[model samples]
Target chain A: MLKKPRNGNSAQHKYPHVGRTVSLASLSAHLGLSKASISRVLNGAPAARSIPQVTQDRILAAAQALNYRPNLLARSLRRGQSMTVGVLVPELSEGYATLVLAGLEETLSAAGYAMMLVTHHHQEAKLTDLHRIVMERAVDGIVAVDTSLPVIHSTPTVTISCPDPHDGVTNILLDHDRAAELALSHLYALGHRQIAIIKGQPFSSDTDIRWRSIQIAATRLGLSLHPKLVVQMKENLATDEPGFLAAQRLLATGIAFTAIFAFNDVSAIGAIRALQAARRQVPEHVSVVGFDDVTLAAYHRPALTTVRQPLRHMGALAAQSLLHSFTSGGNHEASHSVVVEPLFVLRNSTAQSPALSLQC
Target chain B: MLKKPRNGNSAQHKYPHVGRTVSLASLSAHLGLSKASISRVLNGAPAARSIPQVTQDRILAAAQALNYRPNLLARSLRRGQSMTVGVLVPELSEGYATLVLAGLEETLSAAGYAMMLVTHHHQEAKLTDLHRIVMERAVDGIVAVDTSLPVIHSTPTVTISCPDPHDGVTNILLDHDRAAELALSHLYALGHRQIAIIKGQPFSSDTDIRWRSIQIAATRLGLSLHPKLVVQMKENLATDEPGFLAAQRLLATGIAFTAIFAFNDVSAIGAIRALQAARRQVPEHVSVVGFDDVTLAAYHRPALTTVRQPLRHMGALAAQSLLHSFTSGGNHEASHSVVVEPLFVLRNSTAQSPALSLQC
Candidate 1:
């Protein structure tokens, strides 16, 4: 015989004004079972093994019949762990951010953490979004990629390629200076003293660093640094069109150069197109080098010679730092920051400068 | 006079073993105010406007000193709105997925929803991950891209290019058959009867549909698709290597075909590379047409003529479905599914058949 529910007649009034709301207590009472037993079966806890199979079946049937849904927000509040991290990116269509995001996703998922993704195309909106994410406690931590906005919070933040000197923020900076040196040095070795540099955007983190490095390295190697040959992109983002226009600008200047050092692989391909359009053969009329060695870089016509940044590794390290901060109870000091070195990859794009042949 | 919390010293014992946990009640007591008033000030409620500035300042200072957090989980539980959505994708590193994701992010963020991202590389794992996402109540709704996984649950699901006959699940399907007709018809109009097809991955959803359409269109146009000329990739993903290898295999067979229809732009570029290696001039010796006019297709040495799919539009539609379902109280009937058509884009990679040139 089942005992009568104390509030059976008033059960309709208990959760009024809704189209069927089911709670653990309601399901427990309906199935004539304890709330603990219902929870075990519903959550599949270890203690659920002690419950009889018949009782578990009954509980499940009752839950389905009533459309029971465990309140996730309430459960998380009780557990004091959201088990989610916020990821901020400027753009997802770009290969650099997506590649990094892949690695970040892999690591976070392996650690049983979900990633909340938010993108802000404009720079000013990024800070406002960051503030909202923190104020709402939307995530346990944050990892920002290719964003210039600094997370000014104690929310255990990790930034990739976005250096913020703010205390407690761990920055993952790339060694772009080394990448520039490698490209310049390779051009010098190929007997090319006069080279054009298609600089990246003014607002990009790599532009100033790469340009400064190129200048110093050129000076040290006793090579000519012609101001007319350098083409600074007029925009804030690096795309093939800007690269195409930049190469055209360089060509218009008519300063002779045997090689071109592009800001990145897309620009290198664009520069090659401009050269080909002028009836100039790559590596015969001009050898081109690029940076960031995107997937298309390897498949481009001349198979670009570029500097490969460890994008995935940087993403992994950023996730690892945030994870460490979580486990260490928000210390944020254990892994303050990290710097990764870029590598030089030689391919068919670069060859012995045409000046050597002309001199011969 | 600061009034002690009604619960008093036992509050310390209630939440023991933590590094400075501050709740509304604790902050209220510290600031000599009620929890309701403190909540109003912190949450910026209408009642907060009536509170004195001095009292508000005191409350804020005390809360800051105690490192107070509003327990967003509890707040959301009471509000009955998570304001978050889950995004499931096979790969984020792929250009197609990232492009779709950019549009999805734009729409979802504008609608004030956060996206929880998860990637399942293997087909079998997608269902399992979907189950986990739903069971955990990780999001209020879901948008799956390029996945064949059916959203069996009633969690307001929207899928792109993945059709499920199941009720209440909205699918955003692409018109691959029309795209195939467009490509084959173009080649046939150029007086090419024997055509080669670089098929996409065997397991991909579009591969079979596209191939079947190609065969039907070829039959209708009185063209022959030679068995020896078809190259089916072993992998389940499209990339440049397989396209290059497939073109090489066709070349080795010595089968005479004046035109090639590649599965995508990447594979088309690869096929062009293989043709170039064999000293066959594109559009001079053979005409090539690719699908999905990716950004690189335009910048490629011989700008590829291809079919263009509106990936960003599909993404936006999928998001719209999910958002609508949310507003309609998960009815799922508001917008059941959508089918988007692909368009033909003519470029430099294709021209009059080499056979016509030879005859002339």
Candidate 2:
């Protein structure tokens, strides 16, 4: 229990509730200046440059003395810009969406835009309602993350890892082919021939593309993926429970494999737990590779060997693109895709296959 | 790369740019009614109930036909309520803050409140500026998470895990005493006497209280924590790097310890890794206990035996309390602390001490 206030800063007392009572008209009357000139000077409008410096200074001095905090709602109404961006995510969790949100918040805040966050919980009806709510709130733009946007709207929009490309929405995506190649090549070089795979939940936007890219990469490397060794996540959960269950199913198949390529870092951690529970030591009997080297990947026991997606960078890119479209006069028609490459991070979780070592 | 739009439903076309062109005056003229009557009816104002249901239905039908969308800025200015809450966090990461934010977002969204999120990044100047910005934006309430709040203003405020207690601000905190009791008792019952401990970063709000509670619990249990066996985390990182380093420092002290109580789950995982590197097999040679059973804790390699701090519930409590103050006419002077209990999760990482078994 807290006993006393830790920070007793007096700075907040400078701006009190008096600002709510002071109006622009009162300040204009006190300074004997026209309301238009006072408004222009206070708003820093382009036309304010022509106003005499002495008059502007006097108005500003009086406004400050009166603690005249301009109501943002009124100012936004006058300028026709709310200076807010709506961000849509499936849900807020530790992994992908949170990292991207951190990046988006930094960029948007630097540009003086507040983010109005809404989670759809991966429900179609909820997504529709959220879109309507944000639109009704009159956000200047929207950034949809890992959610299929409904349709083209008048507002400028940007999507991060969204598979659906709307007519006017810019898409920021990871190069799944490069990601697959990096993860698969490392495993292949380690001589992991019999590999088990954990696929992402069906609702995830990256599941299909990432799986397809992995299959392509495997075929190119002259490796075949056995149907029995592949397990798909059935539930949309924030925890690693689904991955743990999937790994158990893979083990139940009574098949032998040298390694597992999990859908993400959390799942990889789960798969490793399952292997340990089954008395299969990682990197000694099985080599596990994970994707999305999230914050936990590096610190995970056995330090996950994974493919890194710059999640925060992707979020920043979405924010920047949406802000850019606004500054460029809403040129939504120039919609295009920006692809970012992935990096392969080799850590302790993976190594030379046990079978290969025995053979050698 | 995305090639085409996925959902081509024509729902969005119903509300187009025509809303920008149509005005209440135009609708008033079209209906041959006064602008005041039309506005009242359209806004569903209390006075509109006096009007006939037929007339209200007619007004609504016409507004829908005209695709009239009210400008929220002007509406908010008229009502003097923005229906928005400002959420302040140190930074957005996967573990503590993200889980709390997810809960806050869910409860606030259900109550029709938009969240304007800002991260202070643990800077005094930035926190002050963010306070001013959110106030200027006229947010209905404020929720500060794991950050020391400034002096209270007229705004209704609630804090999640913030150490500071200000007038008119409610604090939602974890019951650290019970948490310490649960963890220490569990460790003591396992016959662990020589235990190493990892302290949280000094900047964390819960660090001091959690440490004090642990010390009290240790004294009550007749277990003495050796000075050389304890190490404190110095960095405010989201990863387990700090924990790993702390554990290595403990190891370097050459003190014989059979178990470690880490500051959090990530650090516990980090300590486990460090122990493994030093050839100490968990539960076989050393046991590890963690706090804040995060999403990855159950799936951790050793399945972290941790203290569960119901983070999402804490966040929901903050939102619900803040909203309650608003509906209750801002009775913030009744600001009180809400203490939530922690759960002790028994998992794979902990076991009876090896020294005890050796003696037996």
Each prediction's DockQ against the real complex: 0.40, 0.36
lDDT (C-alpha, whole model) for all candidates: 0.78, 0.85
TM-score, structure 1 vs. true? 0.84
DockQ of 1: 0.40
> Which digits, one per residue and each the tens of the lDDT, describe model 2 over residues A1-360?
001111374533554332235668778888988889999998899999999899899999999998776777777776667889999999988788889999999999999998889999889899988887887777888999999877656778899888767777789999999899888888899898898899999888889999999999999999989899999998878777788899999999999999999999988888888988999999898899998988778767788999999999999999999889888877547669999999889999998988887898
Model 2 chain A scores worst on lDDT over the 10 consecutive residues at: A1-10
Instruction: Name the regions of candidate 2 deviating beyond 4 angstroms.
Output: A1-26, A29-34, A50-57, A192-197, A226-231, A245-260, A269-287, A299-302, A348-360, B1-35, B193-197, B224-231, B248-259, B273-287, B353-360
Contacts from the true interface found in each model, as a fraction, amount to: 0.50, 0.63
Q: Model 2: clashing residue pairs?
A: none
Question: Looking at candidate 2, what is the lDDT of residue A122?
Answer: 88
**Ten contiguous residues with the weakest lDDT in model 1 chain B:** B1-10
Give the winner by lDDT. 2
Q: What is the iRMSD of the candidate numbered 1? A: 7.7
